[model samples]
Target: MRLTILALDDVFDTGLTVLLDTFSTANELAAAQGNPVAPFDVRVVGLGRQVRTALGFAAPVEPVDAVRKADWVVVPALNAKLPHLLLKALERTDVIEAVGYLRAWHAAGIGVAGACIGTFLLAEAGLLNGLEATTTWALAPLFRQRYPDVRLDDTRMIAACGQVVTAGAAMGHLDLALWLMRQKSPELAAFVARFMLIDKRPSQARYIVPDYLAHADPLIERFERWARSHLADGFSLQEAAKALSVTPRTLQRRAEAVLGKSPLAFFQDLRIERVQHLISLGEDLERIAGQVGYADSATLRNLLKRRLGRGVRELRAELQ
Candidate 1:
């Protein structure tokens, strides 16, 4: 496979290095295995003659036009204190040119992927419209505001819809690369993950701070406060609406508009988060269930499984 890894000014150092290293390692392993086919051929392309990393280092790169030869164009995440800030900064001529390259490649039927904030650039170029994609969790609000037409899921580590693939968080670059490797050779991808000590990250929801996400809007913030207060007692959307001095319909509308979910769904999300926290503190399953106001441990167990794709044991093992 031939990959064109797009390097941008102030690109994330770790995302770029890890992506290159993954393909390089796969190539080495393929050669060692005496596979008849090569694993990958990678080319680094930049808008300008030179590119700088977020770590204050520079590297030379091929021109934007070089992407035409690639089977896949990989856009690594940007390095920014706040990824939303990076999105605003991306209106520069160099970044816009790179977005155009991505748009052109997509129009020509080539596969395109963006990890973390790189997904924003893809959205900026209008490639993600009508496609399911994922981006960094912290920037989900801004992503939704900017690209309301795109089906954006900030929770999933990887979301591949047709030729447009996206991955969440900063290190999701690895997840995206491994997924591509699996498409080529599932067995080899497993081996590469084991050798590199890369465990599966099913969803980015575990890394989300519910408080921060709620603070984006006043109604959501009020709901967050009500949910937290009622976690031990139980949730009542009707009562919550009364407390917030709004009609139930108004509350439901705001929750749906701001969070893209019903009040009940948001309530369950908070319940699951509390369960995760209690488990992290070494609380036993039964005790956690009682504390989180669940009548039985099985209900909480199933909720964890359904939401995170991991059972209690797997989640606890990760923490330990």
Candidate 2:
């Protein structure tokens, strides 16, 4: 397979390197297996001769114009982790040019993939419009605000739709690379995963910090506080709106606008967050259930399993 890695300036060092290393490993593994599978022909191409990484080192790359013959293109995340910094980086001239290149590439029917903040670039290029995509969970609110047309589901570790693929967070780079390898050879993808000690992580829900997401909106922040204090009480949207001095409709609208979820859904998120914390503290499951406003441990357990994709035992083991 012919693959091009888009190396933008200030790109995440690990994100770029992980792709290089994973594909390189796959080639080595495939060769060792004495299989007739064709190895990936990978190229790191940038708009300029060299691009500085986030950690202040230079990587030499081929000119972007040379990538026309590639079958697939992958974009690694930029170093911008915060919302403001990411927004600023998106406006840079080089990134804008790269977005144009991405649009042209996708238009020509080349498969496209992006990891972490790089997904933002794909969305910026209008490739992710009307497609299912995921990004770094922490900045999901900003992503929703910026690209309302795209179906952004930040809870997923990786989301693939049509020929476009997107992965979550920084280390999701590895997942994206493995997914690409799987498309070529699932056996080789499994071998690479075993070699790298990569575990199956289907969701980012467990890692999300609810308060950080809440702080993205003033009303959400206040509502988060109220929710935490009233965890024992049943969720009531009207009550929450009254507490925040806003109408129920306004509260619901703002929550959907900022968090891409209903107020009731976010309330469940807050409950789950507290449940995880209490589980780590060795709290009994039944008590924990009541604390989170669930009437029974079975109900809470099912909800936890549904939302977090893990059982209580697994969650506690992970916390340990």
Candidate 3:
């Protein structure tokens, strides 16, 4: 397959390298296995003839202007991990050009994929609008605020809407590469993954820090503080709104806008976080359940399973 790996200036060092390594490894493995699948025709294309990575190393790259055709265009994350920095980076002339090129490529039926903040580039191109996508979980609130038309599912490790693919966070670069390889040949993807000791991470939920996400909005921050303080008590929308000095409607609206969840759902998230913390302390299921305002251990256990897709025992084992 012809793959164009688009390299933005000051791109995330690991994100770019991991894609190179993964695809190169897949080619080696395929050759060794003597399979019918041919090696990938990969080119790391830049806005210019060369690109500088976040780590200050200059990478040689083919100019995007010289590209004739490609089957897929892969975008690796840039170095701007914070919202403010990313917003600024997106406005740079080079990035603007990259976005334009991405739009043209996709218009020509080339598959597109991005990971971490690179997903923002795709969204900036209006490619992810009205489609389900995933990005780094911590920046999900900012992503939602920027691209309200996009259905942002921050919980997923990889979200694919047709040929447009997005993956989560720093290590999600590997996941994105594997996903593209899987599209070409599932068996090849599996073989490359096993040789690299890469395991499937289906959801980004476990890695999320709810408080960090809440910090995006002042009201949500206050609401999160209230929720944490009242974990042992039953959630009351009226009471929470009263405590935050906002009406229930405003509280619900802000929560949904910034966190993409209702107040009660975020409360459940806080409760689940508390349950995990208490579990790490070796607390019994009954005690943990009571601490998180659950009526019984079974209720908490089921909630944990439903939300995180892991049982208490499994979570505890992971903590160990």
Candidate 4:
């Protein structure tokens, strides 16, 4: 099945450029991996044959009707500064007529997506009224104020299930596309992520943590980094507090506020994750135990059996 992508060039050339680059790179990687997925056929479509960008560049555009038969229609980010003329142009009857074509395709089961402020177009078209969606973190407050009924999660980089999907920011557009590719064709997704030099197995937790820490104080960020680096050292809360020049109680309170867990619990979780990674890498139980700061192999085995419901050999077998 060929994937026809209707790339919306919303008068922001730089944003559109980034979107195209990422998508094309992902497609090429998928192809090179011997994955049996159809290559993406991307077309730049705008209000007219000639579209001018915010940076004062004019590029040839396919007519808006070009998207009528697309398998997926995507809207890239627009400039944050809403140009009065641009907004007025987009509101014209002809543009509305063009958008109706997109609406019809969506109603027929075609996939639709928006990244960053592009989500506003979908919202305007009444596609996101009650859905859980997200946009760029900086625009989240305004989005909530404007669309009170829509549940917006600024922490997520991407959210999708079937026909409709939304991404939080422009940078996450790559992640969104790769995720879709993976769902439709896992080989392609793995290929593309590797080609892009991205870790293919990033945790959903990683995406949420950054947004949660977006407005944190510098001290908190510094302490979190310190904790991450010391995960294998089995640093106690009191030891950590002493290193950061704070009392253990104060550290515990701050950690709970920022990480939603007591300092000791967070440390233990981090240590367990590290042990799992090392074990997956084929480290011996005894070596893994000492490396991850456990007292001995027996202690590590007991901890793994209790927490993960498996012994070292069982975990290794699962990995294989």
* Best model number under lDDT: 2
Clash count per candidate: 0, 0, 0, 0
What TM-score fits each model?
0.91, 0.97, 0.97, 0.56
Candidate 4: TM-score? 0.56
Runs in model 1 deviating more than 4 A are: 35-37, 81-84, 284-287, 311-316
- Which stretches of candidate 3 lie above 4 Å from their native place? none
TM-score winner between 1 and 2, please give it. Answer: 2
Residue 194's lDDT in candidate 1: 93
Clashing residue pairs, backbone N/CA/C < 3 A, model 4: none
Candidate with more favorable, higher TM-score: 1 or 4: 1
State the local distance difference test value for candidate 4. 0.65
Computed on alpha carbons, the lDDT of every model, listed in order, comes to: 0.86, 0.92, 0.91, 0.65
lDDT of 2 by residue, 1-320 (tens): 89999998899999999999999999988888896765799999999899999999999999987789988899999999999999999999999999999999999999889999999999999999998999999999999999999999998999999889999998999989988998888988999999989998888887888899999989999999999899999899999999999999999999998888999999999899899999999999999998989889999989988998789999899887
- The C-alpha stretches of model 2 lying farther than 4 A from their native spots are 36-38
lDDT of 3 by residue, 190-273 (tens): 999999999899999888999999999999999999999999998999999999999999999999988888999999988888
lDDT of 4 by residue, 1-320 (tens): 22333433344565577567756776667667674664666777766666666677777878766666677777766655433443564575744664675677678777888776677666666677788887766555456656767776665677774677887765656666676666566766676677777654222332333323423545456566777787668778777888889898888777655444467765665667777778889888788887777778998788777655668888778777
**For model 3, which pairs clash?**
none
Which of the two, 1 or 4, has more lDDT?
1
